[model samples]
Structure formats: C-alpha cells, structure tokens
Target: MKQYKLDFNSPIGIIEIVGSDTEVYSIMFSEHDQIVNVPQKDTPQVIIDCQQQLHEYFIGKRHEFTFSYTFEGTSFQKEVWTALTSVAYGETATYKKIAASIGNEQAVRAVGSANGKNHLSIVIPCHRIIGSNGTLTGYAGGMWRKEWLLQHEKWNSKGIKK
Candidate 1:
C-alpha cells in the first residue's frame, strides 16, 4: 500500500506522521530538520486528523486521541502496546506491570523490547512506561523527550501551568 507522510513540529522536535488513506501507520521523532519523505501538501485525511489531534495534545487541550490508527507489528508487540494504552493520561506503568497485565510475568524484558519497537509514539503512550525503580527508562524519542512528555502530562492533568 502507498503510504503518506506529514510532519508536526512538536515542542520536543519534529514528529514524522506516517499513514495510509484509512489509518495511521506510525508517528516517530525526527532528529533532523529536513523533510525526507513526508509531503508538504495533499496529505491523507487520516494524516491530517492525526496532526490535528497531536497539536491538541501538545497544547494540553487533548488527553486522548480519537484518530484511526493501526498497529503493524508482531502479536507480542501489539499486546504490549495495547497494555500501554491503559496506563492512563497522567499515570505511569512499569515494565513488570505491563508484563503481568499480559499474563507474562516473565516478559518484563520482552515488554521493554516491544516498547522500543513501537511504531506509534505519543498515541501509544510508550513514554509513560518507566523503570521498576521509578526512574525514566529507554524511550525511542530520547530520554529528554520522554521526561518532557511525562512532565507535560502531569501538569496538564492537574490544570497547572507547564
């Protein structure tokens, strides 16, 4: 299937949004300012919707996204991603909890691995997952971005200034 892409200049950095005409495939952080493959116009409706929702999210106006999205990964990864969505708007979950949630207590490491493989970023809430000791763990978008996102959600959830 032909894929369409759009870019959202978020507070952390430029987020590359990828999708088809019907569902979003992935949203990842871009390290460079260049527009590699995303288009400047003629974006798909799903991409446009994803962009708008992401804008709302960044501004603390949206806590949950309603845009159509699809997961393209292994079943285990999909299960880990699904468990992440239940982490709530301003809450965090440990990898061990996520593994237990999936009825695989021994998959804590596996959960972390699946998180790293997540295609969708903020929408999947992978940044909300942390280490068992309460320290921020690996985030595909970088540790600083993850910290910013967690702090953003904390303030927004409490109606406090960010």
Candidate 2:
C-alpha cells in the first residue's frame, strides 16, 4: 500500500494526516519534525487533497470531511468513532449523548475510552464532545486546545450552538 503525509496548521495546532491507498489511516498533532512515516511520493495526490480540505476546514469554509478512512479498533470502538463522525463542525455534543447515539446509553465510560482513542481528531470532530453538565470535559488534545477550537468555531459561527 502506498503511503502519504500532509501537514495542516489549524487553530489548535499542526496536524499530520497519513494516508494509504487514498484512505486516511492516521491523523495526529505535530509540533516539530516527529517520526512520521512520510510519503514516498512527493506531494502525493492524497496528501494534497487532505491538505486542501484541512485548509478549508481551518478557514471555516468547510464543515464536513469527505474521505475514505480506516479506523482500527474493536467493534464498540468503531461504533463510537462512527458516531463521532456525525458531530458537525463547530458543534458540541456530550459523551452521554454520543454514548446514547450508539445505542449503548449505559456505556458512557466505554464511550469516553473509545473517544480518547479516536485517531482522526477534528475530521471526526472528537473535540466537539463535552461532558454531561455542559462543561468542557475530556479531550486527548488537551482541554485548552479544545476550548480554543470550540471558541474559534463558535466565534466564526456566531454562536449558533450547532
């Protein structure tokens, strides 16, 4: 399988997206030259496409991501990830809501775990999920970044609460 990489400067931070056969396999935050399995082909088509979409997202021109992705995890985890993808850009949902959305209302804890394991981050909009009390809760990318992301989107969106 061919591999590819692209970097995006987002409001939160720089994100690196790695693709294989046009399907995104990993998306992680990067600060410096990290050990990323770079693309063998310079400016691969997939990488370019990813970078363009990311740029649109950061500028608030896009709300949804359209790309094939392979998220490796348990069935339950996959369910959580699938649910997370439905979270619209610049919107927020609760862990309990996400848990309930997956038809496992009693699995909030498991939902949190699976959410923490979300690799696709913003594309999957994992930061859009919050706590049951409307508080900024768990986020793998740090709560400060989460608040910044949400506030950024909120500011641009005119606080529609979407």
Of the candidates shown, which would achieve the greatest lDDT relative to the real structure? 1
lDDT of 2 by residue, 65-87 (tens): 77677889999999999998888
lDDT of candidate 1 over 48-106, digit per residue (tens):
99999999999999999899999988999999999999998889999999999999999
Off by over 4 Å in 1: 34-41, 160-162
- Which segments of candidate 2 are over 4 A away from where they belong? 33-42, 159-162
